[model samples]
Target: MINDEDERFNSELDEWRKLPVFKQALVILHLVEHIIEGIHLDDPHPSTHYKLRLYERYTRQMMENALLIPSEIATADSTDLYDHKMENATIIRKAAKEIIADSKGLQASGYKEAEYLELLYDAVEEFRPLFAEWVQSFSTKNFIIDRWGLFNPPGVSYDDPVDTMSFDSKSFLRDLEDDWDDGDDDDLI
Candidate 1:
């Protein structure tokens, strides 16, 4: 049996996939808004805090394809999708580079913590459109969305211990708050 947290995450992902494009976009935006607001209220150094750190971070960009239906037109195929995604990937790459470069500059100028926060927020915002486009171009090929490669990047963990169908009030906010780890281990990375 799946753990409670895992079930909740998977269940939520399934439901998220089931939502219509317009609705999905709204949901993503809403989640982003809350997360952004929470940045000021929550632990800024937490790994989960940066989940929306980029368009490529969690393959959230790939979710863009959730509403996409493959074209019935004869000319549409992988080549078309690839060409389109490549262009988008280019844009995503550019924005990512800009965010990184600017971040380094901000640090070099000795505005590390304070300015970095604002930069992080803007960088995340830059990713929104490219991510949405990715979702927009998404089409299932052999039953898989095009975002297959981009979903899981380095450092963003999706694994958890909750269930989707049944609410685990037991560990609900606990996991989100990550209250258990005491930082005694130095094996980070």
Candidate 2:
């Protein structure tokens, strides 16, 4: 009995697995960079801790995917691919540093923290077009567009609601215990 969230994640993973290895690496790197940027924005907002935790989880997952890319692309090696991979690593590192520095600066500015975060958000929004242009110069543009659905398919709203309703953790754990007690390992899969 898979839930909607599980199904959605499975679908995303399936799509991710279909990408060329290099594209898969780029997508994960891009997602990590974006998550780092988002984490910076949410760091000062206490009310956004849940969102921050989600970003951290995503970053960890992206890092795992990146670490797995070597095996995925074991047979594919070219000068161009090597250069692109090196360039992407450099870019991701630099972006992460910049985001961190910006967040630190905002924190130290003596301005109200929320106000500073709002300003930082505005700055990012203003520069989004330039960021898009920079992204277009990379091999990742198509991969990003495809994975993120930058262009909507029919009947899918960009503002689609996410499933956020929570369930009791204890109940879920008890159900798992009951399944195991019944000698049913099927649910473990």
lDDT of each: 0.39, 0.44
Question: In candidate 2, where is summed lDDT lowest over 10 consecutive residues?
Answer: 138-147
Model 1 ranges off by over 4 Å: 1-81, 112-137, 140-189
**126-146: candidate 1 lDDT, tens digit per residue:** 545645565456542212122
What clash count goes with each model? 14, 0
- At residue 154, what lDDT does model 2 achieve? 35
